[model samples]
Target: MSELYDLTIVGGGPAGLYAAFYAGMRDMKVKLIEGKEVLGGFLHHYAEKTIWDVGGIPPLRCEQLIERLSAQARTFDPTILLGRRVDTLERLERGAYRLRTDDGQSHDTRTILVAVGRGITEMTKLDIRGADRYELTNLHYTVQNPESYRGKRVLISGGGNSAVDWANELVGIAREVIVVHRRPEFGAMERSVARMLEMADVRTPYVLRELHGSGDAIRAVTIGHADDEEEGTGIERIDVDAVVVSHGYTRSYGDLLAWGLEIGQHGVRVSDQTATNLPGIFAAGDCATYANKVKLIAGAFTDAVLAVNSAMRHIDAEAPGMAYVSSHNEKFREMNKRLKRPL
Candidate 1:
């Protein structure tokens, strides 16, 4: 009995944002629900990272692109509901869908789009005490702006791709870059790991043990050998202005498995049209999977289009396969009025 919407897009990531924009372009009444306090999904986890794969987008920071997506998504002003998690989705007797959230609110929609990527994930924090206090000043799980560390000594913890990648990028900006990892062998790009080894102080098989700081700022850290092979080998103190923990994230299915959708090891099973086997339901972005699927932001853009267009068709069989992009003058006219011209 809730307000009925033409489409209820779940997950406010890139795919959901883009899908909302397109549905609005089609002049459909749409609502965008996001579980996180903010819009952009895991991208927030790497806000400072540069993305180069998105087509025609000049290399820009993750937050920069997220801002662009946020702007583009507002072209038609879809109702954006942030910090609301869709816990379960059920089909109404009349074929419309009803989605219930953890907050005890429900929404009625003509169609649905599942764009939640990898469900909800939280960054793994550094296991050092007093590290939490420095989070506001010197500690960061995701680097929102790389320039913030300019000319300051920085230490990155973790041996994965994110850790090494951040080290590689910060080498030029920070006064000093040091990478501390529990494993000597790194699981990062060979080129990046090689470059970091050459330019940054790469520590091997070391785990963080202590925080040497005062008030809200961290000025140094104590590192220890990670393995019993070198138990009590030694501990070292390194001076640093900031610590970036790229320990990655822990992912779970959450409510997706209980939704009764066909999910696989890769992601939700989706058809060529971005439609799920369930009628009136579709999916896109990293949450949906199919043959020859490209797992990139660029691909997510296409998925949004496909899912929206397919949903449009589901709503009205007479609708075109897709409203032509860059050709529909009528659509572009209104969009252009609100669109920020490239600088």
Candidate 2:
């Protein structure tokens, strides 16, 4: 709502949140705009899921890690605008930048950190007939709870990491688990694919072509080869209780590319300092590309620290020191006590 800020980060994920916090360390007023309803971003979907790769933390659940990261990010209380999509960015005649959002909200900032990971693309849809009717009702794109499918026949579609992971997790809870994929071979990671293939209670290689049944709940599904040209005869119908679709995702770059920002196939290109080709603008996280950039959560934190430092320097011209403590200090007591050590 305000007209200006020292920094405005266009995401609320690890990169954006960390940027806000690091910027705050330099005493800069910051705002983080997250397009989603929640602050954790993709991690919110697998809140109970454990993360093993983070350096110091020993496999904490996605939710726990997010909560701890969020606590540290919010230490300086940056303005967090959830469910707001950044629609456009315009350069002002006087040298500031205006960030416009879908909800008609705008902010003028001296520097912008674009950490909007993957650019707001939604989960892929199943695209089967009759699926639209049940999308918000019975058919779901996300697995909200495994208990909801207890003792019920469920079909999960996709051969990707998310689909395979969900199928592996639901084997014990659902009465039956059927995983359908378009391709003959699953494109998921080796470990997940192996686990899904080994699940005795789950079925695989079934591709959904249509939906059957009516009313409040699903009854069955029609299947066929993803490459099948025939419509009806090659189709096989199977009885089921619920359908979970996890096809994958696409980036939503929209007009940002045409608006003059340098973009690659995955995202915008940036320097090591997170500076994009455009002056006073920077990008980080999944929406950024640079030498030595890594897409992991841990990597994003480093990107945030560097991006914030660069943004502050852009504003002050001669800002002192790194925005965040480059080295952890022994005397800097218990601020991130909630952070769990790696196992």
Candidate 3:
């Protein structure tokens, strides 16, 4: 237990970090809470991937963008508590909040902003029998390091952005790269698809049938045509040194279900201002849902701003609608002064 904060944000993803910065700009005593040891959320999982979607960034790596975001977030001096899972949230008197984490640490705050994007995530597994046995050895889910598969035969399963990205990446690293998907088309960018096929063997309109290997190691895989109506299409066995499945992930809401907030299909239902049904509690990023909501990193930034503004209003009725832009903001100038160490 420590000093009560004006804002205690949950989840330290891109949205959370931005909200913390904005809250600090408003001169509120805020703390950013995170369940994972790492600060960047889902983006950290795809650190190796090149990101071209974020505005004003030209094809930067995910990890590089995270580093920039981390630098910006720390500039605000928001109290950061990592590796702490918020188990429960209690609504205290007069719109304040009390949160208890798994490690028995408690925190109190006047406002709460949930920026948990997609919650805790686990990779979708290949359903083929015994395919999971080789997870640690050959069959892989998340690509931690691309260099590990250097010059080895690789097979990637899935047609999403990750599948196409890995196919493009491993083309230079792996001896041979192959991608298998059940659908006829890929759910990736058109330019990425074009480049990936130039170097990788893509087996779409197909499905993984079996894994051909001995104990704890994969030598090859058996794949079959996805369409049964197409006659004379037999199963094909492709040799590979490693198998990477990128069928997306399974997301769990974690302890959010116990919070007694209004949960919806996409996430917690939020107002136009990003406020939840509960007073002084707000949600942003993928964990919050509103009409015509955008889900990109850029969109999450917009949502975070809205939530922070709503939180400020809730915290103090006389609070202004928004803070001044960074260039003209005195706070930013003051923060810049802090950047230079004392002589």
Instruction: For residues 1-343, write the lDDT of model 3, one tens digit per residue.
Output: 4578999989988899889888888888999988888788889779877899998879988999888887778877889998887778887777688998889888999999988888866678999877767987998887878999999999999999989988898898899998989998899999999999888988878888888887779988888898854544678988889999998888765577778889899989999999898888899998889899999899889998998999889988898999888878877677668767632
Q: CA shift at 220, candidate 1, in angstroms? A: 2.3
C-alpha RMSD between model 3 and the true structure: 4.5
Question: Which one is best on TM-score?
Answer: 1
| Tens-digit lDDT string for candidate 2 (1-343) | 3568989998788898888878878889998888878777667656757899988888887888888888878878899888888878888765679888888877888889888786766777766655788876669887867778798788888877778888888888888888887776787799888887788344444578778767756788888865667677567788988889887876564345565778887678888788999988888887899776799998888888888888888888888748436356432346446548522
lDDT by candidate, in order shown: 0.86, 0.79, 0.87
The TM-score that candidate 1 achieves is 0.91
Error of 1 at 20 (Å): 0.6
How many backbone collisions does model 3 have? 0
Off by over 4 Å in 1: 228-233, 324-326, 332-343
Spell out the clash pairs found in candidate 3.
Answer: none
Q: What TM-score does structure 2 among the candidates reach? A: 0.84
Q: What is the C-alpha lDDT profile of model 1 across 71-129, one tens digit per residue?
A: 88887889899877888887887789999987999999999999998777789888776
